[model samples]
Target: MKSVILSSVLPLATVITAVVGIAGAASAAEPDKQFFQSAEGKWIGPGEIVAGKYKGTKFNCSFTGSTPDGKVGMSLDGGCRVGMFTQQMSAKIERKGREGYKGSFMGGATGSGLDIIGGNVVDARKVVFTINRNQLRGVMQARIPDDNSMTVTIAVRVDDQLVPVIGMSLKRVDAVEVGSIAPN
Candidate 1:
């Protein structure tokens, strides 16, 4: 029963993890400490399955992102909801990655989840990762327009071209101390 649940939710977990992890791990000579720090904290977002067998299925996610004390990547732990179904998702990525570098994770079963085959930092605000699992391959791109928002896109290789599969828009969840007990 647990295996059944995991198998069913694996795809979604891969999508979310790839997007969040690759956003901070893709390298351009060195890891950007500022960029990694900026990605830490809470995030909430909505995502849609733009194409594939699950086309039109939409989900919302909330995550807490954290950077290792001085490592070169990010880790995210969170859950996503599709109607009443919820799945727990998490990813950990760390590397002094180079172009064509297989930004590998030390955890997880050898062939279970997606592997980051390669990645590149497009600019100060965007990074793209090549993701693969056996013959199935794809690209996940993360673009941060500001410290508070992020947009992620995932596309799969289809014959000769990449086809969009998932898209998500996420925003930082700022802590608000709106109410405090008065000391009388």
Candidate 2:
């Protein structure tokens, strides 16, 4: 009965392989893959004060680049009330699930202490982050119905309870870059 046993085993193996292959493909098609892909590049926009005393000033900021190690470099110019400020910052960002990312930011704000840690959130067209109880929120919506351009909205929280301190809008910013970590 060796031939009979061999036939049964072969069919079972074929079925198992097919099932595994389909499962692998489905995982690869997950929505998070899109975020990981679209998140590669540079994004720049203007910062505005919406809710606080500094409600009308405009500032510039950018996410310079993203590394394979999940870190992103950020720079901010202006957007302060008391003094002119420029900042050089770096942070690691990762997709948590369904339009969410969590990471830590550490950098210097002009004329102030240089170390800070916070978490960030991102979706297909929006990004939000917080530093030391202060929040920076940005939303990107499509510009043209068929084009890739997006309108971006940015807001900040001024207090410990995460209140909205300021807000601004920007348009046509690029996406963030993402990739696998390189060998150190």
Candidate 3:
């Protein structure tokens, strides 16, 4: 009688364990969708280059992007006019994974550019982009503190060390539809 009871209890335990494991996996997947949605939008603000030839100079910066279903892409541009030191810079990004991207950065004045080798969005709030090629190695990070505000930091390698080059504060003035096409 005791053996019969033990056999029945063991099967019930196995069933319970399987059900619980499946439920846990489903819950684990919820954050991936939430994080993807939370990071899509258009953000704009003024920023300053902190550690280069243009240190202390200010520029108007704007970033626009969509990261839906783990697909990410964004475009960033900045321009500054400081009496004989005007400049424009731009970059384009496309996602490589849930938190990864590939892009390029270009300076309009010098026409110099670098390849963006890797990038990632973390916890739907913080973002990072990195570049490493030839003489250029740098990282750019941005964080959205709230629905309305964001901060950015850019660092470049100089003399074998990473140096901060741009720091920015941004505001979200608009939201973008992820898959809309413009009528041409």
Q: How far is candidate 3 from the true structure (C-alpha RMSD, Å)?
A: 20.7
Which residue pairs clash within candidate 1? none
Model 3 poorest 10 in a row by lDDT: 15-24
RMSD of each: 6.4, 21.0, 20.7
Question: Where does model 3 exceed 4 Å of error?
Answer: 1-39, 67-70, 75-90, 97-100, 107-111, 175-184
Question: How high is the lDDT of residue 17 in model 2?
Answer: 12
What is model 2's C-alpha RMSD? Answer: 21.0
**Poorest lDDT segment (10 consecutive residues) of candidate 1:** 175-184
Best candidate, lDDT-wise?
1
Kindly list the per-residue Cα lDDT of model 2 for residues 44-157, writing each as its tens digit: 455444444445545554443332433222222212121366544344344444444333333222212211233232333333333331223322111211122223332223
Cα-based lDDT for every prediction: 0.60, 0.30, 0.46
TM-score of each: 0.75, 0.42, 0.59
Off by over 4 Å in 2: 1-29, 67-84, 95-100, 107-123, 126-163, 168-184
